[model samples]
Target: MRLLSMITLALAFSPFAISQDPTTQSKIADATQDVVPSETSTQPLDFWMQKKLDYSTAILRGLAFSDFDLIETNANQMRMLNKIEGFVRNRNPEYRGHVHAFERVTDEVIRQAKQENIDGVTLAYHQLTVSCVRCHQSLREAE
Candidate 1:
C-alpha cells in the first residue's frame, strides 16, 4: 500500500504531462512499449532488475563498441551511473547499501577513466555487478 501510494505521488509530480499533442503522446507511448517487461519477468522486483541489466548492457556498449575515446566513454558511463543512482534513490530507499556501493564504484571509475587507468575501469565494472547482485538479492527477499 505504501509503495502504491508512493508511485501515485511520483506520477502526480512527474514533469511529463499526459499530452493531447499526438506527437508527444506517441513518443511517450513508444517509450512505454519499448520498456515493457518480458513474460519471464515476475514482479516489480524483476522489473527493476531488468532495468539494471539494461543499463549495464548499455554501459558495456558505450565502453566496448562505441568509437568514442576514453574520456568520452567514461563521461557517458558517469552520466549513466548518476541517472541510475537517482532512479534507485527515488524508487528503493531501503537499498541504501547497494546504492552507496555503486556510487563509490562509479566515482572511482570516473576518476580512473579520466586518468587513463584501464584496470580501475575493469575493477569498477566488477564492483557494479556485485552491487547489482546485492540489491537484487535483497529485493527478492523482500518479495
Candidate 2:
C-alpha cells in the first residue's frame, strides 16, 4: 500500500498527469480539433456500431416501402463507414477481412437497388446481416 501510494503521488505530479502550462494546454486543444472524430479519444468504441444499426434499420425501412432511394442512401452510408473502418485500421485481420466483406456486400446492395431487383436486395441484405453477426461473434470469441 505504501509503495502504491508513493507511485500514485509521483504520477500525480508528473508532466503528463497535470498541465502546468496554460499555453501548452491551449495548443493541445487546438491540435485536437483538427483530428478525425473517430481518431479522437472522445469517440466511444460502440459509436461505429450504433451507426451500423441506424443504417441497417434505414435499409430495412427502404425495403418495407420499396424505396430504392432509401436503400441506396443507406448502402452508401455503409460503404462510407467501411472506408472509415479501413482508415481506422483495426490491426486484427479478422476484423479487417470483415470490413472488406462489408464493402462487397454493401456494393451488392447498392447494385440490387439500382437494378430495381427486390429479391436480389433481400438476398444481399441477408448476406450482409450474416457477415455482421459473424464478425461480431469472432470478436467476442477473441475477447
Candidate 3:
C-alpha cells in the first residue's frame, strides 16, 4: 500500500502525467539542446585547443571592457591548461621550451591582469600570441 501510494504521488507530480502538452515537451527538448557535453566526451587535444581559443577570446573581451574578473578567470584557465597532459606530455626539448615560454608569458599575463595593469597585459598578450604561433608552426612541421 505504501509503495502504491508513493507511485501515485510521483505520477501525480510528473510532467507527463499532468499534461502531454506539445509546447512543454518542445521547450524541454530545446533546453536540453543547449546543454554542454561532458569533457570526457570530447577529444582531449581538441578540447584543450578549443579552450585556449575561448579563453584567449574572453581575455580580449575583458581587456576591452576593463573587466579584470573576466580576465582573471580566463587567464587562470589558460594556466591550468598548460599543465594538462596534452600540453605537457611527450614533448621534445624544443617543443617543451615553446610550452615553457608560453607558460611564462601566460603567468605574466595573469599577474598583469590581476594587478589591473592594462599595458602590461597587452604586451604579455602579444607575446603569448607569438608563442602560440611558433608552437603551432613547429607542431605542423613535425607532422
Which candidate comes out best when scored by lDDT?
2
In Å, residue 38's CA in model 1 sits off its true spot by 18
Residue clash pairs of candidate 3:
none
TM-score of decoy 1? 0.49
Misplaced by over 4 Å in model 3 are 1-44, 86-88
Best by TM-score: 2
Every candidate's lDDT: 0.54, 0.73, 0.69
Residue-by-residue lDDT tens digits, candidate 1, 1-143: 45444543553344542432566445434444333333333565456445556656655665574322443333333434344445544556667666667777766666666665666666777787787678778878978
lDDT assessment of candidate 3: 0.69
What is the model-wide C-alpha lDDT for candidate 2? 0.73
Error of 1 at 89 (Å): 5.6
TM-scores across all candidates? 0.49, 0.70, 0.67
Candidate 3: 10-residue stretch with minimal lDDT: 29-38
RMSD of each: 8.2, 14.1, 14.8
TM-score of 2: 0.70
What tens-digit string does per-residue lDDT give for candidate 2 at 53-112? 888999999999999978976786666556555546575888888889988999999999
Encode model 3's per-residue lDDT on 36-108: one tens digit a residue.
1124544444655787888899899988998986776677567655544333354787788887888899899
